[model samples]
Target chain A: MEFTLIKPLFGGFLLGLAALSLLFFNGRVAGVSGILGGFLSFKKHDTLWRFAFLAGLVTGGVLLLGTFPETLNFTLKSSPPAVMLAGLLVGIGTRIGSGCTSGHGVCGIGRLSQRSMIAVVVFLSSGIAAAVSIDLIFGGEI
Target chain B: MGLLMIFLSGVLFALGLGISGMTQPEKIVSFLNVVGEWDPSLIFVMLGASMTYLTGYGFILKRSKPILAESFSLPTRRDIDPPLVFGSLLFGLGWGLVGFCPGPALVALVTGYDSVLIFVLAMGFGMYFFEGIDSRFQRGVDGGAA
Candidate 1:
């Protein structure tokens, strides 16, 4: 029960906070997909907003860690080669789709963007399938 | 100021990914394990994101006008369909293969990881490719926003 409650609660909290900050201070949704996507066709001045968004992402993580060192740890469960490939592919997919799970699935859907809503559903289902394939088909933990 | 705000937000997001160990592929893989020796740290990654979004969005919506862009860029669709399912599958497959996503990849970029660079490059290319089809679909959908 403890694990269940805290897990979703914190997930929701981080998302809610990020979303609000973008909406208020920046006048945007904290959709990583859209933000990152814009960088592809970006001009020099366009880099500013993207940079700011990325900076906030990193900063928020640091702030949380600094305040609650007790809640931090560094661990993982994938091979180096596999990890690299996976990273490469996701980077490609996110760019092509113009958003990731957070941007499309979380923010886009919340705002009810037709593209985002569809995108989220696709990515989330893709994610679940990815999980299944890694665990089942691969026969090795991904 | 508007542009600056976007930069700050990105950095904060990167920090979250780096500090929470989400940038580490091993950690993500372990969490996805769910069977033998399941490491639940991934929960923290999710928690970190949820927290930031919850508080960040909650406070921002109270403002009279948007602080960044000319106006809010709202999504303009309201239906669900098959392409949605197919796209998600592709995304998930890509995610499971690599522990990095757009957010975490950017975070890893801060560390100057060679892998992150490759991933980012390919990801950018992918977006360019997909936007074509996306636009095509949009046209079919009456350009109302597909």
Candidate 2:
């Protein structure tokens, strides 16, 4: 394991803290898809909080980057275009499911919601299948 | 009360990603690749997450009383269904293709990967795809889940 338990522990810990804070003030869950999805709204009035949240997200990453320069290696063996297309499809899936895996898998699961559980299961199984199929059909073999 | 707990959860989850190496797209890509120059980052991440999970969930559970709230809500459904199967398939397909999912994808934006924009746009469409005039209600539902 190139990574360690402390990483996830701290990461999850931060996520939980973020969730708690949102709940305290906004009575909200910190699902990124929903927050990011809301940013397109033209109503400047309604978007302020969403914008703020999204801003915080970006800011958090920026802070991390500044703190940990070693964390920013951006090389992938696959083509960028291919990955982008994949991301496009994922966006569609997140839309169809009414939530992303994190919304469902992490926060939803953390809260123990039926929908989130179902969503997580679907996300995990589908990801595993996709991994297998990609290896089999394309010989990409991940 | 609920809002407070949720916010705390988000911070914790993000922290997990940051620490687990899941927040790192390269690690994720390597994990997905698994065959050629496979990156062992995934193992470390899972281990990192599992170790954290050991105390994390239990600690929350033991609290019996969550901060700012009476209790924590657990997942309602126990069965796997069609949506579960199909959605998982789609999500997986997308992840394999992009090497990015919701969690890592958002965090990865710090790197300014141009592809993150495309992914985020598609994700927006995905979130709104289910509703029409009742969209407000749906957004709330979606928002609540997040």
Candidate 3:
């Protein structure tokens, strides 16, 4: 297999393993949005673990930058304004929707949750539509 | 021990995202733009992840309780509510607009790009904004019923 394909597959396996470990040991879903949201809420006795996980996430990113800089290499396609808007939408949407790619797309689908199946389909289709629209608006710049 | 496992899980998850190319906004946009130059790499990522998770999840569910926690804390809501649909739609638009979801966006912060920082801050604001509105709305409804 090509390196491109192998890399993603291996990375995906790691993601699955991470989710599994969280569930097996901590009995919590490794949903990034949920973890962050809960931390922000300051629920009693609930902040420490979330902080630890987020700190670990940032640490992992630091490690990747140090060891395999190539993996973290990429450029932003959208302008600053567009990027900011996108971030806002993602934040609100994930909060109201109760999940994101990791939570719904990975764990939810793995467990055969019907709601997650619908969510994945909705997000994927809408995402495609939005990308196409942005491409057209930007004359293929985005 | 539970916290340790969760922290390690976060680390592994971030590493996976970095290695899988999910940290790349352009790649995610290209993946979403199926009509354009499509990169099918994300499909493999999801496939590998879901399959691995599904297989392991089956075994994990068989256990009466998690090793570190008293019981599993999984989501139980099954209704296909309006929030699920509309929120996902909005999220997709944002994701398609910038190709950065919550996890990869956070993972990409190590790059120290100004854009990533801006995006994350805005996202936090958005989440906080929604929580405020949602709580007020809920309170209003409760007051009316009472």
Candidate 4:
């Protein structure tokens, strides 16, 4: 197969393996938002593992930068203000919603949870609508 | 050992995201932009990840408990509440706008881009703000019910 298909499928399989490892070994869901949220809460016993995981995330990025720089290539299409707003919404929304793409889109769907199913539908629809609207408003510039 | 495994899991997950083109905001924006020039590559990412996770999860669940922890600490909440729907909607809007969900945004922090830094800081503040509001809201509900 071509590089395009290979990259996603390979990467996705890696993600699955990561999730499986966490659950099988630690009994924790490999949800980024939840991990970050818990870390922020400052619960002493919980913070250590969360911090380790986050540190590992950064280390992984550094590894990618050194080994496969092309994988990390991309320019931000949105302006600074837009990006900040998006970040805020992501933060609050994930906190209140109890999961993000990793939690709801990947793990949640995998577990066949009805709530996750509903959440995936809602977020996908909202994301599609917002993306289409932004593209239209910016005349495809954004 | 448990912490080490979790850390390794994070590394692996980040690697998957980086290799999958998820670290690129533009790729995600293009994927979400179905009306415009769309990219369907992300669908494969989801499909591959979910199918693998589903099969693996089934096997894992058959075991009585995790190796490190006493028992599985999975979410037990099943209710379809307002917070779930509205929060997801807001999250999706943010995702579509910037193409950086929590994981990718956090993973991209290694780039040291000023934009990524700003987005992460704002996201942290937003999470803190939500916690404050949610706690107060919960208290209000309890008081009213009492």
Candidate 5:
């Protein structure tokens, strides 16, 4: 497809705004992995905010689908097994790394955290390398 | 009131992911594929989010505590451990394989993509499994310290 700039840029602005809102009001970093992982270590008082945040996340997508379906593209290129394996790896890895794209990439980078900075560089580099390797193996199918 | 603000934040985050094309794996994969056709649009997403956070956090941190919460829950450890490096490497591999991170994957699941359910399930399992191992490791470390 053709390269388009506006949509992604605008979306980024919203993403930034979201992170800011979380920090400003809740004093919490808007990292998805951390939000989801907190339930595993469930504390009594901790459950409500996490659940609410997750519910809102799902609700947001549902609302967008109902209103502006064109805004999202639900395309899948990986097989079921591959996707599942990927999910498992992501889950374990993010927990071990202590953040995902949102945690490390967005919030971590925003705070200028040295640990986050290192994690971002390592993950981004590895991600790029893996993508290249996958492209080679799949013969550019992905 | 706290919960409501959090819920609203999640909605905003989800909308941003959807609008930024972060929900789409193909776009993510394209952005990652540096040697091949590279899509640099995601940089704007990172830039926008980071800039906003940079500014917002500046003001937010100046306060002694959050308006809604008792304190800010921020990552304090600065050390770069082995787990961080290896875990990040694995995370990258998986991200490249499916182009679905925790955030976008959840968003996609909500949008009626049944296939993403498998990924979510597997991810949950992965998280639990890691937790089990991590707790055990922590126990061993604590014992040694004692």
Candidate 6:
């Protein structure tokens, strides 16, 4: 019920627009893992757009930093090993799952894909479970 | 033209992540803390994105092809498989663990922090490793059962 939620709401709208733009223009799904993974492992002919997209993301970051530096005020809470393991898991898991939050939660759900729905459910469940378990065992926000 | 559009899309996506607080790992971690002081802002994020995209998708599907492409490249698989379930579960676990999915992690890479840099490198390695293993399994190089 807090007004702070407005920021995420507005940002979410932009994220959706971003996905819609890709769908409308390129006939592609704007899945971050898919884009980056393909860029890392796919053939050369399809790499250009992926590269350009990532470059654009970096450019956006620069623009945001220059305009509103206060948006990025949080810090990493996990340790080095935890971070590495999580990254590895996320990279492989997203590739195997065929999507992530953006792909499944936003685009897939918006398009009414059953597979994406199931994937989103699984993602939320596991995410909450891991978070709770970590908190219970680690006894803090790790 | 298509490439430029994709670039712009990425820009928008990153800006959205930044604005929505999705780029902040701790914010996400807080959201995951459902038993504690749960932050429901991420819920609004998904809601806002879903509504926006759903409306656009409704209109976009009316067309045969996209503006710059011949066909809509969408996921066609409808069946539920072990990989899909387990993979999503694993991805969610990782997301909970690190609070950095592929997109925000990329955005966070701009911070030039050692943690973000290391995570990105490891993630890249993980993706490459999956490709290597999957391809070998496809070709029966390591006797990997299909």
Error of 2 at B90 (Å): 2.0
Candidate 6 lDDT over residue span B1-146, tens digit each: 77888899999999999999888877787788688678888899989998899999979878999998889877767777777788789889989997888888888777878898889988899888877887777731110100
Chain B TM-score against the true chain B, each candidate: 0.78, 0.73, 0.91, 0.91, 0.91, 0.90
Q: What overall lDDT, based on C-alpha atoms, would model 5 receive against the true structure?
A: 0.80
Compared with the true structure, what per-residue lDDT tens digits does model 1 show for residues B8-97?
555545444554555665555545545535567655545455445544454555556686556655445455654444444566677756
How many clashing pairs does model 1 include?
Answer: 87
The TM-scores, chain A only, for the candidates as listed are: 0.79, 0.87, 0.93, 0.94, 0.91, 0.93
DockQ of 6: 0.60
* Residue-by-residue lDDT tens digits, candidate 3, A1-142: 1237898899899999999998898777778877887677676988898898888889889999998898788878578888889999999888777888998888888888887888889889899999888887776455
Q: What is the C-alpha RMSD of each candidate to the true structure, in Å?
A: 5.0, 5.1, 4.0, 3.9, 3.5, 3.7
**Share of native C-alpha contacts between chains A and B (below 8 angstroms) recovered by candidate 3:** 0.74
Q: Lowest summed lDDT over 10 consecutive residues: which window, candidate 3 chain A? A: A1-10
- Candidate 2 global TM-score: 0.71
TM-score of the A chain in candidate 1? Answer: 0.79
Clash numbers, per candidate: 87, 67, 0, 0, 1, 0
lDDT of 6 at B35: 86
**Higher-ranked by lDDT: 2 or 4:** 4
- A67-103, model 6: which lDDT tens digit per residue? 7676666678788898899899898888788788888
List the TM-score for candidate 2's chain B.
Answer: 0.73
lDDT by residue for model 3 (B84-128), tens:
888889989999998999999898999999989999999988877
> After superposing candidate 4, which stretches have Cα over 4 Å from the reference?
A1-3, B139-146
Docking quality category of candidate 1 according to DockQ thresholds: acceptable
DockQ, candidate no. 2:
0.35
User: Residue B66 error for model 5, in Å?
Assistant: 0.9
Per-candidate fnat, comma-separated: 0.41, 0.40, 0.74, 0.74, 0.73, 0.75
lDDT of 1 at A117: 55
Off by over 4 Å in 3: A1-3, B139-146
Q: DockQ of every model listed?
A: 0.34, 0.35, 0.59, 0.59, 0.60, 0.60
